[model samples]
Target: MSTVHIVGAGIAGLAAATWLLAAGRRVAIHESAGHAGGRCRSFFDETLDRTIDNGNHLLLSGNVAMMDYLRRIGAEDQLTGPSRAAFPFVDLSDGSRWTVEPNAGPIPWWILLSGRRIPGTSVFDHFSALNLATANADATVVEAVGGEGPLFRRFWEPLAVAVLNTPAETGAATLLWRVVRETFGRGATACLPLIAREGLSQTFIEPALTYLEANGAKIAFNRRLRAIEREGDAVTALDFGDVDVSLDSTDSIILAVPPAAATSLLPGIEAPLESHAIVNAHFRLEGAPAAVIGGMPFLGLVGGVAQWLFVRGDIVSITVSAADALAEESTERIAELTWADVAVALDLPASPIPPCRVVKERRATFAQTPAAEMRRPGPRSPLGNLFLAGDWTNTGLPATIEGAIRSGEAAACAVAT
Candidate 1:
């Protein structure tokens, strides 16, 4: 069997390796870093004396690709969340709180109830979603939905920023609409939140590595691909910094690195160039499982610097998405600002922030503007035997775990043929 050479042992590469290996194809994964998981992993923070994920992510039941990937790697039981769809939100300005709880079925009858909707939002405000269906591909979230109303400020803006990882003013409306159609449109059953029970590496990465190794797959860490040696429409060899890997005629390659890395390896490839940043501040609090919001593990915040706050045990992680400007601030400043928001949301003391570590993922995700979205390429590369797999690729979704997994699967399918 021709071995499938996968570059970058991130989620995309790992996902592609698993699918191909299961199909009886020989697989070898090479990663530049000694570790896998790329952006979706956890690490110990000495300051906090606890393991903290680089960024907090909230997955929904409607994320079909991610769920399938987890099940395949036998990590389906590694997640925990509310029994139903309950999104707790707080307005920092007025100290108001509410939970957006969708009904069990696809019909969003819950929106009709004032208590279930966002505070100060009328029942007719929910009708703004209808505009999404008619939104053209070039429409931004602000343009698609009239950006003024209370519903847009309290609901759409936050949701768009979280989903697209870009300001709602420039976020691609089509991508946000697709997310809404998949999760919220399907109702509470599909929108049920699922977060890693332990951590990202434990739930998504380590299990996948175990499965791949158990199935006799080769995982080579610290083997960076310096260049791609091509021979007329086919990848002939891969040049690492110290060693060069010569590919056989029958063998195939899967390039699953980030867009910038991919472009360096295969020049002139169309990919999202502009990217946004995400700032996360993890604070270690005193009590075990310090707090909960509406029986959910995470809480959404409006009129604050922190967009979302996630609690796991005594550690609280505050996330600010599309935070390019915030990412530039000093770590101390970021921590202080985020901790203030956390204090208000969690009803903790305002003074003396807990032991905290601020993480800034500068290129966390590509800019999900309409123009950037249009630049995303498909799985098929110019080389006949080489395929591309990454969240940044044209997966018809934002750069997310679901999109990353789907892109890998798409690459695997393309390689198989």
Candidate 2:
């Protein structure tokens, strides 16, 4: 039996191991962090006295890879969402509220209905998305879709930033169009928004670990890969700071670490070098449970520092994507600024802020711009026995759970062949 030495215990590595093990291959996972789930994990915050995810992510039903991974780990029921595709948004500047509700079929008849479309946007404005069909590699989100308009302000801009984690003015239009094609283009059934019912760890991590352990997969924490020893066209060994792992002819390697760490280990590897920041603020509601967003647990916000707000019980967590400037602010200041928006969006008093925990991920994701998209490498590497898996890899998708999981599956498939 050949043993596959997988580096990194994030979702990408876990997904790779899961697929390999299911194919009757031996697998071992090595992670630098003590725990799994990298940026998508949950932790107990003493300040809030609750378990909160390091980041907030929204998954659509169209994410087939993510759904398959969850099903493989027996966690298909761990997510919760509305029965229909409804995204409720609030404009803090004017206190106006609306919900973008797509119909059940592929035909977007919802756009014709004023109540289901973005407020003040004409039907022709909605059709402007067709402009992306002919967008070239150099086209940006603002270029493919008109930059200034009620539709751009209320729909395209927020969707681009949330999906790409970069400003829509320069973010790749092709990437955003790919997302639209997969989700919104498919129909309301595919665009249904879903979030972890309990926490990220419980839903995506713990169950995966359990499944892997039950199948005799080796999982080692704090075993960071510092260097790769190459002999001819194959990787001969992996060097950790304290130990080394020798690879035989049958043995293979899969690198599932971040782009920077992978670049450090394998110099000259093409990967997205630029990254953006994301700021997530979790606050514990004092008086009562958060007034849900149109009977949902999350709400989209515009004209505020925050972009998305998720309510889990008494905890209200807000996500600010492409928040390079906000990420530089002090935690106290971030909490204050986001809370003010949260107050208005949630219809709560703004004076005294509740117990809040601010988490700033400096390199949340690669800058999903036109140039950065060109830097993404595929699963197969120069070495015959080595492969790569991560959202940063060329999965033809943004750095999302679906993209990460798909990358891992692609690497595992490459290894099998």
Candidate 3:
């Protein structure tokens, strides 16, 4: 069996290795970081005396690839879901709430019937989104939903951020359309939203590693590939600092690091997209609400200090999606603004604000601008036995775990074939 060298032990790399190993290929994963789960890590906050994730991530029934990956790794049971076909939404401004039922299986019938919970939304909203199904493939989401009203702004804009990690104005319309069609428009089973009952590392990454190890896959921590040596069409070896690991001429390699690192390793590779930031604020509060926020685990904050709040026991975390605007702001300032938003949205009066942890990942995601769309590369590269895997690649979706998993699967399949 041919050996496969996977660079970066992120979710994508892990997924690829898992697949390749299952195919009876010898696999070795080299990671620069000492720990696994690159962006999806968690740590015990001693002050709070609880394990906290680096950030909050949600999975939708529409994310089939992710769900399948989870089940394969034996962590699918770690996810908790609300009753199928129901999503709750709360308006922090007025404390008014609504639930968007999943409707019937796969196809989103509720979208056509439920307008009261989704403020400013109407039956036309479904029609408008459906129209996008036939829109020009090259058009931006903003162009596809031209003049569709605040419903587009309220529901679509946040949805785009949650899906693509980019704003609707710059996000890919075709991707959004596909996401909606597959998850919301296809059937009711695709609409269930699953939240990680435990930390992401425990629920997804760790289980994946265990599965890989059980199958004889090796993961090398602190072994970063500084460069790739190629002979004509094939890669001969990878250069990690202080070591030169030779590879079989037929061995396959998957570069699953960030775009910045990819550009450096593959000098000729072009990444047209610039990186963006996401700011997440975690607060340790007393007496936090246990009831699921509206049926959805998360709520969109409009015209307020909190953009979106996720309630996890004593820890109340707020995520500011696509938060490039706050990149230059001080941590204190960002936390202050975010807490104020949470206060208003959660309707808390005079509650003591516990010590807050503000995480600002300046390069959390790639900027999904129009030009960036053109820069996204596919699984196959110019070099043979060398492929790319990451959410940043041309997975059609935004920089998400689902996209990462899909890209990894594609890369692994490419190598196997």
Candidate 4:
């Protein structure tokens, strides 16, 4: 069996290791952090007496690779799906609210026929999407949605932020096509949202580690890889602090670290370096409503302080995507703004705001700019045995959990080949 050395214990690395182990290969994983799950980690909040994730991550039924990975690690049951394909969207300016539901068929004919969901939008509003869907795969999202329309501003813009983690003008059209074609285009129910009922560590990462351990895979924590040595087309060894760990010429290596870390290790290699930020605010409430705030797991915010809110028991967490403006805002200021929006939307009685926790990921994802899109590297690197795997890699999609899993699977396949 071939020995595979994977650097970075993030989702990508863990997925690759899991696949290799299942295939009866020798594997060793090195992570800089003490624990696994780089971005999708969770920890116990002693003060709140509950588990909290670093950030909220949602999955769609279209994410086959991610779902498959979960099953492989024996954590598929930890995910809960909403009853229907619906998302609540609220416009704070006018106190108007609407629920966008999936169409009866695979193609979302409701969005094209019904105007109630997307208020102030007409059937023509979705013409651009249809046109873009049939356009050349190399086209950009900006080129597709160039005209001014309410749908472009409210629907497409917010959707772009959620998917690409960037504005529609900068996001890639090809990637969006893959998302729409694979999900809504394939089947109406394929877009149903899946959320983790428990913490991410419990639902995804920890189980993967357990499976790896059971398969005799070695995992080293706080072992930061400093450099790589190559012989001909293969990577000869890896440098971590004072140790120079050697690898067989045929042994494969998957660099699953973040883009910045990857670039630092391989100075001359080209990889996208653009970054986007995500700001999340968590509020502990005394009591939540009997019926959940709308039937949807999350809601889109337009012209509101809160972009998306997740109601986990009494703790209400709000997420702000592509939060460049909120980068320098104080936690107290953000909490105040977000709570005001939440109170209005959820009809909360005036009460003293409970303790608040704020999380800011400055480099949460790569900027989905056209220039940045071109820089995303594929699984194969210039070095034959050294492969790349990460959401930031060229997975065709944006920096999401699904994209990360796809990249890992691609790298594993490359190693096997």
User: What local distance difference test score does each model get?
Assistant: 0.92, 0.92, 0.79, 0.82
- TM-score winner between 1 and 3, please give it: 1
TM agreement with the true structure for every prediction: 0.99, 0.99, 0.93, 0.95
Better candidate number, 2 or 4, judged by lDDT? 2
lDDT of 1 by residue, 157-242 (tens): 99999999999999999999999999988888899998999999999999999999899998899899999998899989999979
Residue 263, model 4: Cα distance from true site in angstroms: 1.3
Clashes of each: 0, 0, 14, 0
Clashing pairs in 2: none
Q: Which runs of model 2 end up more than 4 angstroms from their true locations?
A: 287-290
Q: 1-417 in candidate 4: lDDT tens per residue?
A: 668999998999998999888888899999989999999889877666768888888788778998999999999998886877777788878877787777758765786556544888877777777766865555667688763577776777777777877767777777777787877676657878888887788888989999999999999999999988877767898999877889876788999999999998878777889788898888888876434336665667777867788877788888888887896799889888888887777778545667788888889998876677788899999888899999999988888898898899899989998
Candidate RMSDs in Å, in order, are 0.9, 0.9, 2.1, 1.9
Off by over 4 Å in 4: 112-116, 134-142, 290-293
Query: Cα deviation of 101 in candidate 4 (Å)?
Result: 0.9
Residue by residue across 1-417, what tens digits does model 2's lDDT show?
Answer: 999999998899999999998999999999999999998999999998899999888999999999999999999999988897999999999988998887888789988887778888999998778988678888999999989988999999999999999999989999999999999889998999999999999999999999999999999998888889999989999998898999999999999999999998888889998999999999999756656567888899999899999988888989999999999899999999999999999889997999999999999999999999999999998899999999999999999999999999999999999
List, residue by residue over 1-417, the lDDT tens digit for candidate 3. 678899998889988988887778899889999988988778887767888888888778788888888888888898887766565555666666666666666655666665643766777665677656776766777778764575675677777776666777777777778777777776667778777897888887899889988999888898888888888988898999888889886788999999999999898776755877778888888765655565456766765555677877778888877788886888778778888777776666534566788877888888776578788899999998899999889888778888899999999999988
**Which candidate do you rate higher for lDDT, 2 or 3?**
2
